[model samples]
Target chain A: MGKRRTGTPTLEEVAAHAGVGRGTVSRVINNAAGVKESTRRTVQQAIEELGYVPNLAARSLAGRRADAVALVLTEPDWRQFAEPFFSEIVRSLGDALVDTGMQLLLTLVRSEGERQRFLEYARGGRVDGILLISVHAGDRLPDMLAEARLPTVLLGRRSGDEYVSYVDADNAGGARTAVAHLLERGRKTIATITGPLDMYAAQSRLRGYQDALALAGLRGTRSLVAEGDFTEESGRRAMAELLERHPEIDGVLAASDTTAVGALHALRAAGRRVPEDVAVIGFDDFPLAQSTKPRLTTVRQPLEEIGRAMVRLLIEEMEEPAVAWRHVILRTELVVRESS
Target chain B: MGKRRTGTPTLEEVAAHAGVGRGTVSRVINNAAGVKESTRRTVQQAIEELGYVPNLAARSLAGRRADAVALVLTEPDWRQFAEPFFSEIVRSLGDALVDTGMQLLLTLVRSEGERQRFLEYARGGRVDGILLISVHAGDRLPDMLAEARLPTVLLGRRSGDEYVSYVDADNAGGARTAVAHLLERGRKTIATITGPLDMYAAQSRLRGYQDALALAGLRGTRSLVAEGDFTEESGRRAMAELLERHPEIDGVLAASDTTAVGALHALRAAGRRVPEDVAVIGFDDFPLAQSTKPRLTTVRQPLEEIGRAMVRLLIEEMEEPAVAWRHVILRTELVVRESS
Candidate 1:
């Protein structure tokens, strides 16, 4: 880690690094009306090199800084914000911005039009920085923001090779641990519930499940798999469908705790005893894990830590653009509980 | 109801409605940094008369509009955001902002210093508007913001009348219904779990609980009453404490589902059969309500609607500054399930 600057580095250092006119550096750094990007980049490069962290406290005193940061969540489902997974991140992000004495702007870009508007707000300097989360397939928000040279950090990684700073959990490895636990239990007829396939997290979890089954020489039967949108209702219905298709299945692994909770309900309704007739496990050991009957053995995503990590990465990127883009994969743990 | 504008309205209309000059209207609306109160009021009157709304979109074409809004929640507990109450509001707030083509920024503040910094950002025009949720006692945030005359609205009522707009549910009525349900079940040894006494919601819920007991002519046992922080663990612990204090207690009305779920766990662990040994009811019909074993009979807070209402109130407050501040109290309903 680089030593923290005593104060924002001098404009002279910025000018020296950018290799531009002192006047040009002043114009760009000040965001003075007529500076071009070529000039802006020179100034940005100079600022970046000189460790010129915009002092929000001093800036607030002057009321000259943009004084705001925009949080761009590219959610395919708008309501997922109600889900604890997303809310935790927002809370942390908000807390971090408060420390900087910066206003936080949250945007949900569900459609292409929303994304365009978001770009306008972000690029127009309405926000000094951007934080992106839950990017889906064909989502171009991250790329656009990065290409525009906006300081951005993502909550999760994008699949593309482009260098982007992000913080994510080891989803595939976590799923494998979950499935392997069921395998070692001698539960032969195990089924799985997957999240939306378009999402990489979902895709990775599914892949891990498949890899585990292949290693055990178990058939990846279509009947043993069902997809859910990570809600308990969907989990219950999926479990029901899985039971109907493969009545002899003895174990289940769900993508989330809420889903697993639903599965438990379905199993109880079907007169199946947990860990006796059907052992069940879930991911993201939410508070509901303990709340559920027999409790739930699930994968702990370290979501709060993930939130903290994302903020840290975003702060790093904001402070040093030349800093290497990072993929900080937090480790996941398997917590054994009554059900599994 | 007023018609939503398709685009920006004429400046003349704003000036006429505000009963001020075109120059004054231009200065205030454009945020040109200097305008007297009387002149600004006249301009605002003219604009209101002309049915004018500032053309942020048009201004953004010049790359100058700050299209982001801030949702500042004065909550310290991390678990509070984990609860469905805050998440639901955040989701609805996101939806409402999306519809209006504004970005939402979320921030958490607990201390006086943090509050001051947050207000500084808002006053600096970092965000187009502000949404404040003050959960704890003696939170002067709403009053401070309102006094600063920032475009602001509260999620719940403040201690004193401050001419600020707000949206809240009928918490007292909801709690009353919950307790009443307990009495109807023929459970005479009724007990209740109250939320934090410092909060108005908690106080109101307690009032409702008392109201039901009073109407039923049943003794409100001091030993049977417990207080929880609206968490499952707190609920569980409170239930255990209640049982230890009053082993003969046969009915319970918990302040939140999380606490109720905890109570359920405690009851089952203590070898007490639910409904047969003791009846349980909780508030906030979160997903946990239905997921609970025997299902938790709870009071539905219309969480999403409350969130939507908060956004609507905040938006209206921004649109019409002198409009009568509204205190919206949406109704709650009792959801009967197996628990009681």
Candidate 2:
């Protein structure tokens, strides 16, 4: 093996050493397909031996893609940043991009000033595209990126009429399934603890709950619903309020697993035994669901599939630049456990 | 507000619109100091109004920094990616970089081939610096990065004799404090479940356990120690084996919170009453600590402080490449709860 040279080696030297053309070396360096495996290995060996480092900055300036994507968090709440839900999404997205040779840049935009700063960063050609997660209704960052001609994909939509490309789990369908399962267990009087209604996912979940009750020929009264922010505290508060107002309720559906955990605490405090007095179900089968007392029956979102679909759509839009905006919805399943 | 023009706008056009000099606009765009706050706001307003996007690629080709940092994960185990430890580090790092106008790029290098590709990417100047986490002993990527003259910082050291800059907690001291607490609680016959010894953190923790026992004038026999890999399953297995081998053990020290939870499970299965028949302590007072059956008494590392120190050191090194490498060790405190 040759010792590393004090001076940098050029592409031509690596090509000559590998006994291949300069183009072959360049293709191998860029990770472009079509190069023979054996030839690629030979060129990589020569490059390693000579310590030849390609100038990505120069390649990018010469009209080549940066081969990077930005996963920007648009939520203003810092607490959400530490949630397991966020971690799951990031893990899945990182796994999805591992083989694409594109780096994932994580950004947090909490305020309008930071949003403008990120817009400039994205438009500056530092990334091939952008992936926005946790975007709330009325957020204009997505439209701004679209106007700037940057390929952008979102993890969830702001509304049903979202124009930007997005990949979302079937929130309504998942909620409907959860409620239907409760009905099948012979629970006639049911109530719901919903997430903050500003988000479309929360709205869809509420709609699903209402639709399930209607389908069962049960009247979903106004007193049967309470609002939560998908937080444990909110869930507890909502559950307590529902218990106080409607003591006859025998079934409860929480919009999120965290909320369900809170409701469990409230039920225990109120002297209600799970599945005996009041059966419950939650959404987003988080890891915490399995650890709760009596466990939790919840709706499981296909998070990994959602992450992969978002990446695929973004890459397609980046390559074509004129591809129509797409909306892909993945299915969710019910994971039954002790609570339900 | 003026409508966005069809053609791309230049820096000169932005300066003309803001009624400022081209150099003034350039300084504002680069986020360099010396421009008045009012002038900076005016230039920003003009840039946003005209939809002017700076070319970061050309700026990099001109020898300017990319103003981005890479947070690389060298761990090959995919399961670790979803751990709360990883999420906390990423959240803190992102928060640290938010006001600095530097984006955080996340990369996972699991295989040797990916390591070589990352080397070329770093050498190509895609980022200003690197922050590595979960590096195992004898990992050569850090040294390779150092040889390439990149500003790098590690969350934890590969070994005590690490030459690269890093920020680590007082792992040994934390462990010693935990064991000392157990001793002070009048518990003799104590045993320890150690983390994988290959990791410096784990080794230090084990050393601390032995030192505490020796200081207390008790024999730290080999039979009182079992090794684990910081996973819940490993912890459960190690604790079960220790119980079977030495049923007289009255107290236990687990290397991590997850491990402690597993120990709790094992103790429960064996019908050992905590703090009565047996007591347990854990490290890394993670969120899981507070929610455990009896709640967990564990050591709390200053994770946020460690993150801020790492970012500060990396920025200093990037600004002055000649700066001497510095090692930062933050203090840890013990949080006592019902478990102990």
- Per DockQ, the best of the predicted structures is 2
DockQ scores for all predicted structures: 0.14, 0.42
In order, the first chain's TM-score in every candidate is 0.78, 0.91
Candidate 2 lDDT, B1-340, residue by residue in tens: 7986533688899999999999999999878999999999999999989878887887787855788889998878755665567767777887788878787777768779779878878888898899999999979999999998899999989998987999999998998998999999988888999888889999999998999998999889998899998888788999999999999989999999989989998999899988788889999887889999898999998788888999999998898774688799989999999888
lDDT of 2: 0.88
Tell me how large the interface RMSD of candidate 2 is: 2.8
Computed on alpha carbons, the lDDT of every model, listed in order, comes to: 0.76, 0.88
Best by lDDT: 2
Model 2 vs truth, CA RMSD = 5.3
Which 10-residue window in model 1 chain B sums to the lowest lDDT? B56-65
Q: TM-score: which candidate is best?
A: 2
Residue-level lDDT tens digits of model 1 in B131-210 = 88745667778777776566677776754353567777788899888888888878888888888878877778888888
lDDT of 2 at B61: 72
